[model samples]
Target: MRVWPLLPCLSALFSAPVSAEADDASGITVTAPRLERSLEREPAALTRLEGRALAPARSGRNLGEVLEAVPGIAVTNRHNFAQGVRLSSRGFGARSAFGIRGLRLHLDGLPLTLPDGQSQVDTVDLDSVVATEVRRGPASVPYGNAAGGVVDLRTAEGFTGPDGARLALQGGSHGLRKAHLRVADADEAGAWHLAAGDLSQTGHRDQSRVDKRLARFSTTRLLAGGRELRIIAGAMDTPFAEDPGGLTRAQWEADRGAADPDAVTLDAGQRADQQDAGVIWRDPASLPGEIRARLFASRRDFEQQLPFVFPGAENRVGYQRAFHGLRLAYGDDRRWGGVPVTALVGLDADRQADDRVRFVVDEQRRVQEQTVDERQTATAAGLFARAGFGLGAASEVTLGLRLDRLRLAVDDRHAGSVDDSGSRTFTEPSGGLGITRQWGEQTLYANATTAFESPTFVELADPDGGGGMNPDLEPQRAVNREVGARGPLGDAARWELALYSVRVRNELIPFERAGRDFYENAGSTRREGVEAGLDWAPAAGWSLRAALTAADYRFVDFEDREGNDYGGNELPGLARWRGELVARRDLGPGGLALAARYQGRRFADNANEVRVGPRTVADLRAHWRRGGWRLFAAVENVADVDYPANIRVNNDAGYYFEPAPGRALRVGLAIPLR
Candidate 1:
């Protein structure tokens, strides 16, 4: 594949020598673990992306632009809004059929991943985010539940920049149109920020269009005695997002922009409206040490029309969902026996309820007869504790443990239908141990961790097409061993490398039956991978960031329902090699950036019969500022490469490919409101 040749270039850059001027990020601290600590002492693989460097000249389209360069992760389904973007870490979330699964997402300390292990990022305001942190592998043991990895986003609190309002307008190819406005101010007592935006587009493929609007508000108050209070609220509305369902390879080869005929015929699409609010309170210096608490709630109204059609089966689904959560924690820093110690204890509780209904659709896509109606509920709680003890001034050891309980239940409400009410309960424990050693400016770390993931309500749906849960579905468990090192290279650059091996039991795998998605357990699976990254400031006004990941994921023991042995087969939908290169340059009042991403070949089925080819895509962005005005432009897919943006794994109907757009252009202007 073409991506192979770039590997040598990346290796040479990582090994190159540099000067002795200290990098600006050498003393950076991370807040991903709810603790403030230097990155050098952290015993895990973590990447922090600064929004200031990423958001200024970008097309405010999706999260892929913000996260694609991070190593050990994959982002796909970029052109489809109805299904949202698919994010996978170390092959953990590769089997997700719809929303995000097997990973935890948080925005401003509030959990975006529901108790049912489903997440949607449509509500996140990318323009307002200030930073993002991603933790890979089993290091996410403290968060509990489907935490194959963790993504945390922190937005601007409106107090840093000048007190002013800015208005932005953008227009581009494919009938794209967008408008955004942001206002912020601060005083001695508090600070406030408000933002609103609207976007509409005519996509590259037939039957693919999207219209969306978003609004957000945030405020912070300075309380007495070193205490603080923060409040946040956001709303999102998508009038319609058409789904141009996956197409067969032959169809794609014939016409890359062709949509699935079934999708067009069935008018497959989705509509969603959501609102969320949250509050956080913190006491930095209390009698019992530092204390923090958070409360959040959200409501969503969603409806969708699928391309699936069957007698006595539903193809139109609608749901009203309510989700809420609360978290509390306490941390203390003390010295015992002349050694420094830091400890934290926390509790997390969350609940989700859905009132769902489904109906059979006619040729015109109108609902005909009701087929299923049910109320689903999921509750999850966890208690966790972590401690770190300083072995010496240059070394530390950390230990963490968490116990979690999850309950899922469904109540059949359909009249004159067979009752399929059922419930499932799971209790699991996760733990991690780690040690870090510092040698001058370099640090070495090793960790062993355990994690468990219970089946979500959607994943537990019976394969027999019933209304209740699957009786045989069980939670998946994983154990990971990892070693890594990170430090400065000649003071002008920073580098990190990690090697990890993971073993999974009862691994969850997805399949399609009669046009509907279902999940089953693989007897065993193994994943081993290496990730490397580099950041260098070669000269003033110039910077480069590069990352590469190579993973080998396979089934150790697995047999299908038809008794087909998948053992020794490579897991589908994940590539063995992925890499990204980004370069940025400053020109006084203007800046420019270029990014190229490469994805290696992968499989579209568990049997490894269908192979997806590799491709490399590049994007260019530039911005110029004068006085109080700024103009920006972006060119996506600069090389006009044709590639499969997403691959639907193990599809029985031979529908697997979703082609990405060739080339697109966008230009925008930002005006300061006096």
Candidate 2:
């Protein structure tokens, strides 16, 4: 084990007294107010990594891998082929497992989770992500049904420029390699823009690999006075690998710390393809008021294959989901009865369907047996309203509310009958209130919110073959209380701190019976945590960033139907503390950056029966930029450390877990023409 000095590197990078104006060439914008808006609207705590922060580190094929330094977030590398990244908000479920129990994910203002409340966000392309907005606690309500928080991803908007293209290639450790190409064009009239790209990677792990391609086109037209219409269409194809499951403590020690076990060689594969199109109309009728309406549709096909050791035991399953929705919104920044107010209101609707099939693999590498097929459909509609008012010269208050109705139905294909086909309507209500006071450059705020999440069709399905749904299951509800502050330290430094507590009732927890897993609502639980972050550009060509988050979670009066008391047990998948530190400086022409990250030890089981060891990883990145061309490279897991980001333990069998990638290097170059 080795420990490195943290101060020398930071001080050396920022010893020079550099003015903020001189760093404008790096594309780091100082929009304090815009940044504050993100903080105020987000529930818990957040960090924005964009512009140069992403450009040099965009070596990996997955966005999750590139963002591992963000506090309280971890990336679960399922294999070289399939990478499932999980975000731990303080100490919550990983991998979106708990149905976003304490977190929510949104892409381009649309919910990616299925109608069943189950969401697997494995398809987003990092190249297309322009910004990511994170909210830590259950404070996020605009998107609906999220008790944790929300992560909103904004994709790149088309540019109005001449035709241009970019090409990037990278190579790294563990047979890691990558290539990327992007092309874009804007019509002379600036009314149309088109962008397309393809990205692929050969992973460091034995079974890990990835291939993805994407395309997007958008156009805008000027309508009658002060009105414009825009349309966008996009598509993506991605395929990745899934390696064998993780091992238990006994197996790990027996194998002398090696990941290889029976050599049974069970390889999993996944293919995801999607297409989306949307249209938007905007009218700016007044200097301070605007109206916008949008309609969108998307179709996604997801397939997974589990090829096991036993002959004919291979299973190929897939699901198809289609979504369509419309939204109308009005916003105004004006004075209402001598009080300044910012108001917004909107309506939204969504329809989704899921189909799954299980197939067997034969000796001839063909699919032979077909076992089960199931289909489910869900529909939901909602209305949202938000208002912010200035209480005085330095104080402000905000209020928000949302109402939703959801219905679900399931049908079995093989039985030739609608085994569990029933529609139940649920009206979910959510609201939040916040008050902010400004002192000099810092803003102090406190808020409370109420949020609800309805059970998905999968969660409500009867495991006993009752041919009926569970009408007794109630929606999970949460009350979040938070207080925080944000401000600038001089002109070149920024910092934020937030403390939050969440109390949840009727939380859904997974239970195992007869080798099968099902969901049940536990009693009550509570989580409290503090999240703090800092960013400083203390000198020219240098930057220092760090974040630390700690959480305490426990079941409060929690029990199952069997009268098992889970109270006093640490919440599953919750880590008590996590943090990261980075120091980067310009090395004249070609620059070099170094980062050190530490992940605290955590429990692998909900019962807090097993503990995973802590890990420290160091990374180095170097790059050069000239004109429209840039070359970059990075080394991850420099010490070749081995660890598991997620683990699932079963007493009789062993551990089924996801491992992190070993030491690997990636090098690539980007060329842009304008």
Candidate 3:
């Protein structure tokens, strides 16, 4: 198979290091400079998770299963792998129907987000992730568009010890199964880590089945001039991932586990193959100022079948995607007017292209009509600079500015009646100012920033039977303000609290009619919230952690094209209040844990009529380890409650419910090879 040959070669290139030493790994520390800095120096709300700690969530079939208790972030899907996990952070990406939008994702410092601000989490192997870092808020200065926040996933550097391998196998209710492997080694010359996995699931819901395989390799090398080079490669292939569409209230009540009838009739689903690679070369200590450069690229082949057949309008779609980009950044320390100051400057550019076509497929999955053919592209470029100066012994102030330009173009090749070919561009400026004050172990901070989001080609090609970009569509923009504090509580506890408010212009919203999706501007919206997190250890080997988020996200001014007003309504898809509590006790080479996750009532549609929250779910996990062997067991939804895992906001016919599974059990074993 192409994957087998590809893995070992990539592993050999990265693992052939001269000599090195192994370091003990700790909690999630990220590569994003904006987040790597200490909490005392940052003004944004952020959360980090060590992959090893995400046993319950990561044990499942999708990445959404890996995000369990992070506050201000929501993840859910209808157990349909093809549609991917629908994720939203602080009410930013809740309207998405397929794929993730309104947020940014970076893997090992490489661009996972395309130039047009669309991204998917399906290709990255969660089993291989070492850490997860999420920054929740407006952030346009560090990254470009769709920076409603950032989710940076970090992979292992090299072999943990001299050289070793680990394997994990799991099986559970609903025909869930998974197998994963990790191998690594390092030396003075360089270091490398390789991981691979295969997962298959017979979902609880009818017509929900999935099969996925993935591989990842990372390597780094040292040069004589104190220079460094790191390379990363990954691949994913999915042979089958069925989509079970949403259900109406009556249908959901009748059979919570049934797939949408239309989806079953048309055999709706998708198959995909993705490959990506990235490299970073830099020298920070060799010169007075640090210099760095990065290059990355990716290719994907995909085919999808929707529920309807429009004949000339095309129902089945296939596309080939290619993307690549480069970046240059420099940073240094200097003294100005007898005061210390640090400055940073960088330039980034990227482009993405797609060869897309549409076909009408018969019941046997045979293509009958070739209704559409076209090439689509999106490009973006940006320049940015930042400065931070010491104000006093315990105070600091910082400023940053970024300028960006984005362009989208499409070429019609179907020879259809309409030209369906044109180009559009947007130039915007963004910046932020922040102040931080430190007192003993406590710190207080304030900040304000501007951000924006450009529509992706998927959005432009609205599946609501449209062939060209919606000329009425416009970019969404926002300004955010925030204040926060973080500090230690006595000698056994720690806490963090943040308050924020954001006002947006031209917020993009989705609507459904006749079984197709359409989008429009919401005119304006206001979002204000509070985030609190606490971790307490009162005694040796025992710990307690909790997080809470409360927000008022509502439309300040909104109306559909039909002149129906939708002003002053709570946001659909996100609860007004959410919280989580987890407790753990460490045993001899093992641990036991219990947790509860809760959410307040949430609207299921734009009209704020259908509510789907005010729900709570409990889970438990226990594990034992000795030497190089370990065993673990977990129970999810311990009480067997009926609840919605996700909602299809504003779906026509009120088909807004995607039910969650009842009580389930999972067990796994881990073994080591030397």
Sequence-dependent TM-score of model 1: 0.95
Residue-level lDDT of model 1, residues 274-356, one tens digit each, is 99999999998676679999999999999998866666556788999999999999988899899898888999999999999
Model 3 C-alpha lDDT per residue in residues 1-674, reported as the tens digit of each score: 01222223322322233122212112334356442345456656776776334553348466654555676887777366878888788789888888788888988889788999888888887776767778888888989899988888777787454368999999998898999998998888999999899999888888788889999998999887889999999999999888777888888899989988767877888899999999998887877888888999999999988755444435688999999999998888878898768788999999999999888776566688786688998889999987777765566687989999999998989886666777778898999997766655566667889999987776665443355678878889989887776677888877877778888999988887565677888899988887888878879988877889888898999998778788998878888888888888888799888888888898988888897759898888899888888899889889988888888888877888878888999999989977
Per-residue lDDT over 1-674 for candidate 2, one digit per residue giving the tens place of the 0 to 100 score: 10113223322322333333321112323211112243433323556676555546665355454454565555444343443555556444352432243456666555566544565555455566767765666643466654355666766555532357776776666555555555655554445545555555454433445676676666767666678777878787886544444556665555422443322243556778899888878888644577877888888887766434345453566788787777787877789899988777877777888786767754344677775576777887878887778765556788888888887776667563445556667778888887766555455667788877777765675556566677666777888777776767888888888777777798766554332345667688777776778888889999887878777777776676568788877766556777777778887767887777776776665566677777887778888878777888888778977776455432224454456666777777777855
Which rank order by lDDT, best down to worst? Answer: 1, 3, 2
Top candidate on lDDT is: 1
Off by over 4 Å in 1: 1-25
Each model's TM-score?
0.95, 0.85, 0.92
Of the two candidates 1 and 2, the one with more favorable TM-score, higher being better, is 1
lDDT of each: 0.86, 0.62, 0.79
Which residue pairs does candidate 1 place in steric collision? none
Candidate 1 C-alpha RMSD relative to the actual structure: 4.1
In model 3, pairs of residues that clash are 18-189, 19-187, 19-188, 20-187, 20-188, 57-65
Indicate whether candidate 2 or candidate 3 has the larger TM-score.
3
Evaluate candidate 3 by giving its C-alpha RMSD to the native, one decimal.
Answer: 9.4
